[model samples]
Each structure stands twice: as C-alpha cells, then as structure tokens.
Target: MKILVTGANGYLGQGIVEELSQKSNVEVIATGRKVDRINVDVKKIPVDLFEVKDPYNYFGRPDVLLHLAWRDGFIHNSPAHIDDLPKHYSFLKK
Candidate 1:
C-alpha cells in the first residue's frame, strides 16, 4: 500500500513515518515543507502545501494521504498561517 504523509518532518510526523515505514507492506512517501532537512529513510517529497498548484503532480498518485502539515507558528495563527488557509482549502479542493 502506498502511504503519503504530509508534515513528515515534524516531531510527531517523524515518529509516525518511522513506525509506518517499518511495515513490510507499506510504501512510505514522506512530504514536508523542508523535506530535504528531514532525516528519515524513505522517499521524501519537498512541497510547500500552500504554494502547490496540483499536489498530485508533485506527490504522484498515492493510495492514501495523511494530511498533517501546518504552517509555522500555526499554534498562534501567525500571518503566514492565516495566509495559508486559502491555500490549504485550494489544495483540499484538488
């Protein structure tokens, strides 16, 4: 099964990817805004969820997508986070 995980570089995401990747039947496709910096042993795709046109174009067609990504300072609803809301909606529409 192909599994796509967004925010794959974050604290919880890293652990989730590690655990999921250990499954023999799972194919992990890890994505993050700074995926290049993520130190995971899996297929990594760097994507700014707020700027992508067609996510599938970059992420390929996966069997499932676990949306865990959030803009920086999301907890406090910073400017970037606020601006990302529309982008998030657009991505979801696609």
Candidate 2:
C-alpha cells in the first residue's frame, strides 16, 4: 500500500512515519517544507501545503493521504492560523 504523509517532519508526523516504516507492506511518501528532517527509508518530497500549485502532479495519487501538515502549527487564534483555513479548503478542492 502507498501512503502519502504530509508534515512528515513534525513531532507527531515523525512518530507516525517511524511506526509505518516497520510495516513490511507499506510504502511511505513523506512530504514537508523541509525534506532533510526525515531520516526514514521512504520517498521524501518537499511540499509546503499552502504553496503547492498541483499536489497530485508532485506526489501522484496515493492509496491513502495522511494530511497532517498545517500552517502556523499549534498557534491558535493567530492571523497565520486564520490564513490556513482557505488553504485547507483549497487543498481539499484541488
């Protein structure tokens, strides 16, 4: 099974990637703004969720897409947080 995980460099994302790596049947595609943070033996693609014009073209269609990447992470009620809403919608619509 092919799984595409966004924000693969984040705290929870890192753990998720590590756990998924142990599965023999899974092929992971780890994506984030910075690719160097991911040390797993998986396909790494640098993707800033809000900036990607065509996500499908960059990463292709995966069996499962784990959308964990977020802008202004963990910062509630901030301007950056508000800015993320539209981006999220755009991501889903695309």
Candidate 3:
C-alpha cells in the first residue's frame, strides 16, 4: 500500500518514516512543513500543509492517509482525532 504521511518529520512521523522505509510492502511518501530531513530509503516530499490549496494537495490518492497536523489548541499524537476544517478533510477524500 502507498501511504502519505503528513507531518512526517515530527515524533511519530520520524518513526513511521524509518519503519516504513525498511518495509517492502509499503511506499512511504513523507511530507512536512519544513523540508529539513534526510532518510534516503524513502522518497521525501516537502509540503507545508498550511500554505497548500489543501493539506493533501501534492499527494494523490493513498491507500491510507495518516494525518499528523493540527490547529489552534490541538496537540500532537492524534491530528486525526480532532475535527479539522472541511477543506482539509475534503482534500483527503479526494
């Protein structure tokens, strides 16, 4: 499965990128606000979720989208748990 990982340079995303890189079953497409990262085993794409047309803009359809972004008083660990604005979630559905 192809996975699009948002906030992939953060704590959870760091581990996710490394773990997925070692696996042959999934392709990890890593994106973050700042592109300052390096893990050659996986393909890295720099995307600032805040500035995009949508958070999922550059990314095409993915088998799974592991959202890891937040707004306002939101915290880490569960960006998906919070109710993101319609424009954001709608992007993923596309």
Local distance difference test values of all predictions, in order: 0.80, 0.82, 0.68
Deviation in Å, model 3, residue 20 alpha carbon: 1.3
lDDT of 3 by residue, 1-94 (tens): 8888877777778787788878879988888765456464676778656456644446765677887644432355555545566646665555
For model 1, how does the per-residue alpha-carbon lDDT over 1-94 read when each residue is reduced to its tens digit? 8888989888777888989988999899999877754565789988677677777766777788888887673467578777877777788778
For residues 1-94, what per-residue lDDT tens digits would candidate 2 score against the true structure? Answer: 8888988898878889888988999999998898687778889888677777877666777788888887667776668767777888898676
Clashing pairs in 2: none
Runs with alpha carbons beyond 4 Å of true place in candidate 3: 38-40, 54-57, 71-94
| Model 3 residue 62 CA deviation in Å | 1.5
| Candidate 2 Cα misplacement greater than 4 A, ranges | none
- Kindly report the root-mean-square deviation of model 1 from the true structure over all alpha carbons: 2.1
Pairs of residues at least 3 apart in sequence or in different chains that clash in candidate 1: none
Look at candidate 3 and give me any clashing residue pairs: none
What order do you get sorting by lDDT, best first?
A: 2, 1, 3
Top model number, TM-score: 2
